[model samples]
Target: METGAEVSGQAGLAPYPVVEEVSSLLNRPADEIDASVSLGERADFSTRVSELNAKSAAGDPAAFYGQQLLLSRIYGLVTQLPEGPTAEGSIVVQEVLRQLEQATIAAEDGMLESGILDAAPAEPTAFLSWLKKLAKEHRVYKHPYYREFIRDQATADDLRHYVIQESVVDGRFDDLLAMMQVGTSGAAKMEIAENFWDEMGNGDPSQVHTHLFNQIYEVFDISPDELERSLTANALLSGNLAVLLCRYRNLYAEAVGFLGMTEWLAPDRFVQVVHAWDRLGLPDIGIVYHKLHITVDSRHAAGWFHNVVVPAAESERMRRAIARGTLWRLNSSARYLDERMPELASHR
Candidate 1:
């Protein structure tokens, strides 16, 4: 079976009159024939889609750029396609989705490297200074997030296998219920629907699933094992700031200041835990970071900003405070990483 890329490329492979013959069959103008066949200088949009999907599965920034541009053009084409809701349009949509899955998978895998969470602790006052520097960066970053969404490598090789995992909680409960209605047991269906409803209702964080909740603390530690497993095994992992930054490098530096600061400072208390564990002469005993970045500093920093900054931010003074807070966040992350992964400084 020819992939979309193959079909798209051959769309223009024949002579102009031959191409006109194909266009006439579809009731499209000759210009449409040329443009669709050309698919742009970098091969047709479909080829770019295939390439972008492949690259994104590996967390490459360039793939993100190309994919975004390709999607924009294809979305326009999708609207104007002669068979808007037929097999042809569905094929293109499926191909686009295949590529998106690849990119998202790559990003999740990239997060698994120890470096993403690697950081060393700094002295209190010095850490404060670091935050000041980073906040300055976040204030000016501007990359929009909602553009060019897709699922690249969803199934093993099947293109139309629902590449991205859809959350039934996103106002799609009835649709899912319809699927379960076919011939499944009423008891099982009701049980699943109730669980879904519970997720949608989120009354308290602690009451959430334990496995779901504890992983929050693991990322603040030195082990990337959980992240590694997640990247390799799952395709519907929740999105985070770091993954978003990797995809949108244009906003990478600025956008991460706030999250970086929170990650850097949120686990301060955890640092104290390391110290206490050491003082008590306890064994390393699952202690990922002894005197370092693993702990509650990032949590505290996140709390302080969310609780203090968002509620009180109104005037120039508040704006300055927010800036100060974000800088402290970003600078601290860089400092922590600089100490933990000095090799990265060359990139800086």
Candidate 2:
């Protein structure tokens, strides 16, 4: 719950000289530099750096940005090493330089974003309203790709591909819920745990959402092994990566935004998808997952928006992060559907 500053405290870990240089280069204050590099005391510096590296390797946009910032700071330090610093510099300095080189290479290979730190913030209400408008206007249910699939334009193989890809994505639901639970307290923690409980069926084996979803796949003859082995689509992968970036970075407002939009939009989106399954004459057992989301997600969405996003997003940066998370979800889904639409038409 604490900001990186609050958890790590202002004392003790003074900014390294290179970090200060980076701060000056970026026109940011020393404290901001410290926070950027500190990333809070929740994990050691190396471990956090490693995690960021992994996310960058996986193509997470935010993580890529963070990696750039981190590497720039380290590079600044490398530049400050003693003039005698040849390839034969102190082992410590050499190792730092080695890491800096690797990170720079990675950044060059990965997606690049400029001025991320300078992104203008927005008021929470305006940001949330923008997200709602975006969602309403670009609703996945309204997408032609989905409509075509629902209209029986897609072959059984196409439908099976979709089901498998989605089931693989759904398998991450519990993990996402658990990740969002971190750094929360009191009512927030309680609500999140309740959501987790609902997801896991309050510890009852039969009612678990994942199990219910698995049953739906079974009706399609998509064996659990098949679902597990399915390749993740890029859009789904990016969307999940965005959520994980927010969680790992402890970006609380972004996490709230991501979760809130997901809950709010699930029912609206799933309603059509579920109807499509029925139109295809799939068994009722295979449709419960969609039915369950339509019934439960509205309440979850409202609760999250009022209790979490509204209360937590007090700053422009936080609000902007929230907006980014929401848009990331919407846009990614849109892209996913668009890419798959042609497959259905081609099948026809």
Best by lDDT: 2
Give per-candidate clash totals. 38, 0
- lDDT string for model 2 (14-64, tens) is 223332333343333334444455433313444455555666567554444
- TM for every model, in the order presented, reads 0.24, 0.61
For model 1, residues 130-170, the per-residue Cα lDDT tens digits are 44444444421210110101111112221111111111011
Against the correct fold, how does model 2 do in TM-score?
0.61
lDDT of 2: 0.56
Best by TM-score: 2
Alpha-carbon deviation at 46 in model 2, angstroms: 16
